[model samples]
Target: MAVDAAPRRTGTGTNQEGVRRHNLATMLRQVHLGGPTSRAELTAAMGLNRSTIGGLVTELTSLGLVTVGSAPAGPGGARGAGRPSPRVALAEAGPYVVAVDLGVDQVVVARVGLGGVVHERVRGPVDPDAEAWQVGAGIAALVRRVVRGAPAGAPLAGIGMSVPGLVRRSDGLVRLAPNLGWVDVSPGSIILAALGVDVPVSLANDADLGALAEHGRGVGVGIDDLIFVSGNVGVGAGVVAGGQRLEGSGGYAGEVGHMVFDPEGRDCHCGSRGCFETEVGAHAIAEAIGCPVDAVGSLGDVLDGYATPPPALHRIGHQLGEGLSGIVNAFNPQVVVLGGYFRALHRLVPGDIAAGVHARTLPAPLESLVLSQPGLGADSILLGAAEMALEPLLADPVAGLQASLAEASSRLAG
Candidate 1:
């Protein structure tokens, strides 16, 4: 996990004090996620004792991370039950996150609060062929606009950029992005330099972010193992196994678009023959119907045309199903989410794909399985990007606490 630089240090605190604050922040975050809970509930959720929860709540209250609310009377809300304990909720004005989705055609910028509220977002066209520098400039402009619009003193913790294609996480360098025609572009550094701030920036593939977003708040909630397939100009999948995002060895775990669907059908920009993108991807469907991919007028028209099962559509759907079946058997995920441009095509392909997976998979994993379009469509990726940016804050309470302390220290030194 990554986080923005530590905030200025507050009055020379000892290491023990820092550790105490970190524990308190962690406890508060747990309470906020579980929702208005009592000290007992917090202890249960954090695996800590009642005394620890009490001390943590006191610290969080002083720092304005947690607030006391009306407590529940336990079990039946009976008046004769034991005294109700104070319930806790996150404070409204905690630090914020900036989520940016850098798409092939547009950029989506969102200012999100700790509570998952999208306080602001801007979506519009961006130069598809813009140089990496230009793209960073556009993002910086959007980020500054968001910062300006935030409540007068809102603290921006960090920025998360959801990109399309392979990203090298080590330095936030984009190793390759065929769609964007970018190579070795350091988007994080560019954005930080442009914004004149050194906030920690995280970059991940769009589909990966989409999976996080969907799992965090959308259709995949409560599902620990799943796959999210995003179909647009290209097709990609994000895998979550055992409740963790799978970035793979090189962080390119989900390049479904490059899967070989046709070895002799057509040429792909990826220099592969009959890749998955040639058959079921948005561009492939559009080309199959002899229309502009963007002009195909939505997935409905494409799938509707598939009812006749033309040579191209039938073969494409069948092959796409073939690829998906392999995934079902290998992972036996609880569910599979199909989103992006393919969402509109769900009505037409779900039955076929389900049948394919059922036919190919063992009986047990197939018995209670589910495969469908993500309940969230285009917005899924955007929301996912926002979630990615907020991930560090959620996963690492110590880093955020350290940042606040560093900020306090800087102010005093000045």
Candidate 2:
């Protein structure tokens, strides 16, 4: 995924060291996103002169974060083209981050490199009702297994986790997760204790991570203002406004599923009656299809038959669009992305959702809104988690790398 543009200098008298670090990060980000760009391309994208680009490239190459090499051949043979431009790209052996995506029924762990590539991954099912510590221990084991499989010379930057709950940004505590039956749990601490490591751990809402993944690497790459709706056992949303995540006062801005929709509808796990989640959540969809709540695989099998969509799937799609209309009216986002089960439902009944949104939303926002499915599929949360873990390193590569290396050394020594 491409990094956001470098922050403009606000005033003169900026610290020279800080400026150099920022410039270095900008160049690395350009390579991370575009892949093996030539010096001229970096100059244009970063708005820096040739000398500055060359110096930054040299520094990054020495630090082992990037490599300067010859660009690939074009459509024509070497005889038909000018001399190839020298290109800069992220090194294959660059540092990586461990990404964890904790869902209600499964946990996914991945080792991801700088350019948003997953080098290795491991995933398995977990009991949703397991004790918090047990869940943490399971995840920690998975993380260790993935870490052990990393390429030999690549340093581990950090760990990032996507939890299906309300996370306290201050301390990486999971405040609430109705589907997982967790409350006031500190999964990060548990995992750290289990692994006995001294690395940074970041925690965020799963839907929020999904939004970040879509914005950075998936379908919403260049679109700044958009909403990512994650529909799993429960529903949630991640909002991006003006190219920034709208995390709100206490990181609770995107809990759109809890909004009261039908006062007379079914009750939700969050203690609300007829909330939006109760209408379109996985359990609700399962009930509509007369299947058990844990019958997700079976549900997919049934949905596979709905290529022409029977009435049931169509109604679900319509309800989803109806719920999304309120969000579109409020946020006026440029796009609305459906993830997880919602993406599956859309595949079954795309036209119904479009019609429902058209019927309910106002013309102004509706005119510009594009409905989309996640490009990263089930891996969006994991990829986004890696991005969060890698941000500090991207901001100040040298310090971040040194700190990570020191931590790794301490772990080995102990």
Candidate 3:
């Protein structure tokens, strides 16, 4: 059990009392990122009074989330010309976040702390063709391995898992995943029951989680409207609009893989032919190049051979772009991010895709559309899952932050 990254300090019990604590915690996190600061700096940044900041800092120091050290004189001088000031910094104590990215062939787990540092990680293999229950067992086993490696008795605040399929997130049940041969499996509950601890678990499509992870800290940081195009066993896209992942009525909003590309093209497992996935997904690339699906490295590697781009790669990129053209024209997003297993167009496809988008879409909609890859690589899904678990906490923070801090305090007190 890893300690909660933002643990709830036990001292604050109720909402009214915890409001000040919540404000202080947020301010301290800001200070940790921005560096040591004075009461004046905290006041301006957090819109809190000097007394409030002082009391909050005291509580934080006692809970080991902040530390006090000597501070230089103010912009002017100390009190009059002889007083010394003290500075507070975020304490590097407590638990951390546990995130797992479960793929058809592998599962990766990571521990992330405050300041967004991935402190530790573990990776293991899974059968791409395994049954849903077996896959759940593998994921559960991998998570336990990661948790046990943490410092003894560390308490975890939450756990998030990314699966390669459509997910009913409210209950952590995976509805469908053709590549993994799974259907109607409740992986979140299985993992939780196996771990024997009650904590929030978030389950989502791997590509969507990957997009969120990258957008949260990587390439799409400042952008509000973006689309993540993931090309793997099957092609999929995760749309982000108004700064949030778009979950359709049933949480299957971005199943771009099923969109028909060519009515007469190769048939897909989803009972569709000439689908975007039929021409651009990993299976298609493997079929085009004459290799087993499992042997293909990644999209980046598949397109590395030709001195000049190969026709097959370009054709695939072009068709993939064509598929995206509709999405761009319809959504008119600020950027489109490419991930998954597309080897040929990690960078080149965006321009080609944008060209198709421009030709099909109104000029105004295509004016500043940018296409790019996630700054974070394959590990994005793991980090994204951790982030999803923390979102509810980040939203309100007061009650949740107190709960996390209190859990950490109880563990420490014991």
Candidate 4:
């Protein structure tokens, strides 16, 4: 009989110092995700000894990334033989990022700190006819407003932008944002030019960010497999399988709106006849609600105003479910989050949408499926953008902080 081998975890750290750094990152990530964690709990969660957890916590505290909390002892509360393990949390006044959710209808900018905390935020209307650079300038203004709230001595790690269209993952390049009327634009450099600041910048699809946020800290926190359906001006999706985002080749994976939804329904701006957006996008919803397309900012907000869902919304809800059914069959995610306008639709026509999904999805995938609204609500993409900006600091706290401080010093000198 052949002997079977147990599966091993990949990416075993090779260098001694590298392994230490990785452990530090792991500890920080645990505390960042779970908020304040006791030393004993960190040890248990990280599979590390208490002494190592204590050292990591101490270093993290010295680096200003984490703050130590009380060690009050109690039963079944990560207690130990000696004094209770101290609780560690992300420092409230440590580092932050400028996060921007640049939607076609509206834009939200915020200064976000670790542990998904929003220090301050500002919102602005996006003019559909405005140029991409103008939009960047507008976002820069919002960034300035939010930056005013940053604590003294806190480092601004970088900026992250959430766009409504395809963005190249290799570089924070906006390849095409049809809703924003942008193509091959560099919003990062534009904003930096407007602010005269030097910092790392990240841009990703809004739906992708929404999925990232929802998975990391929102409705799908405990669920590893989930899909986030975005119902902004268009229909798109962000897929997370096994707790990792599925950014396809060229990073244009989640363009469900362009998926041929209907063959004979209506002509889409993408030159396709009856694309998903044609049937279930903002225009379709606006048409159903008897509101002008321009009058709509957030589809969810618009739907929320109605006391009772209109009968026309039922058809849209069914269509939404049919679209999601395809996703459910393909991905078999544990949860499906309804974000953007779909949130309100899910709230109002839960039965209609649920019926369509259940009726169409494969039975097996349906067995472990759930339809949920984003727990973070409109802030999903905003926080997701922050997550992207904060990636560097989370990866290596010491080096990341040093670089951010140097950049901030350079900005001040200039």
Model 3, 1-414: lDDT tens digits are 111223334555545555654675576456534566666677667766689778877866665556777776555664544445677765454445678877666678876654455767888777766666676676666666655555544445567788778988567678998777777888887766655556777788877887787677767877788888776567778888888888887787788888887898988898868888888788776766666667653444655554565555656666777788888887888988887665246554445555555566677877888877677765666777887766654443344455553343233223
Judged by lDDT against the true structure, how good is candidate 4? 0.84
lDDT of 3: 0.68
Give, for candidate 3, the lowest lDDT window spanning 10 residues.
Answer: 1-10
Off by over 4 Å in 1: 1-22, 71-85, 289-291, 294-317, 362-364, 375-377, 404-414
Which is the better candidate, 1 or 4, if ranked by lDDT? Answer: 4
Model 2: lDDT of residue 72:
71
Q: Compose the digit string of candidate 4's lDDT tens values, residues 196-308.
A: 77788899999999999999899998788989989878888999999799999889898989988779879987778989888888889999989777766676777989888
How do the candidates rank by lDDT, highest first? 4, 2, 1, 3
User: Candidate 3 vs candidate 4: which has greater lDDT?
Assistant: 4
For every candidate structure, what is the RMSD over all alpha carbons to the true structure, in angstroms? 6.2, 2.8, 6.3, 4.5
lDDT score for residue 302 of model 3 = 54
Most TM-score-accurate candidate: 2
* Candidate order, TM-score descending: 2, 4, 1, 3
Error of 3 at 214 (Å): 2.8
lDDT of 1 by residue, 1-414 (tens): 111222233477546656565566566556544556777766666666678668778877766566787765546756545666677877676667788887777788987776667788887567776888998888888887766666544456678888888987566778988878988888898987877666767888888888887777778878898889887567888898898999888788888888786588778888888887777776777777676655432444455555544456555566667777767777778888887666656565556666656666788877767886786667777777766666666555556644533342222123
The residue ranges of model 3 lying beyond 4 angstroms of the native Cα positions read 1-15, 21-42, 60-90, 296-308, 348-351, 395-414
RMSD of 2: 2.8
Per-model tally of clashing residue pairs: 15, 0, 16, 1
Q: Is candidate 2 or candidate 4 better by TM-score?
A: 2
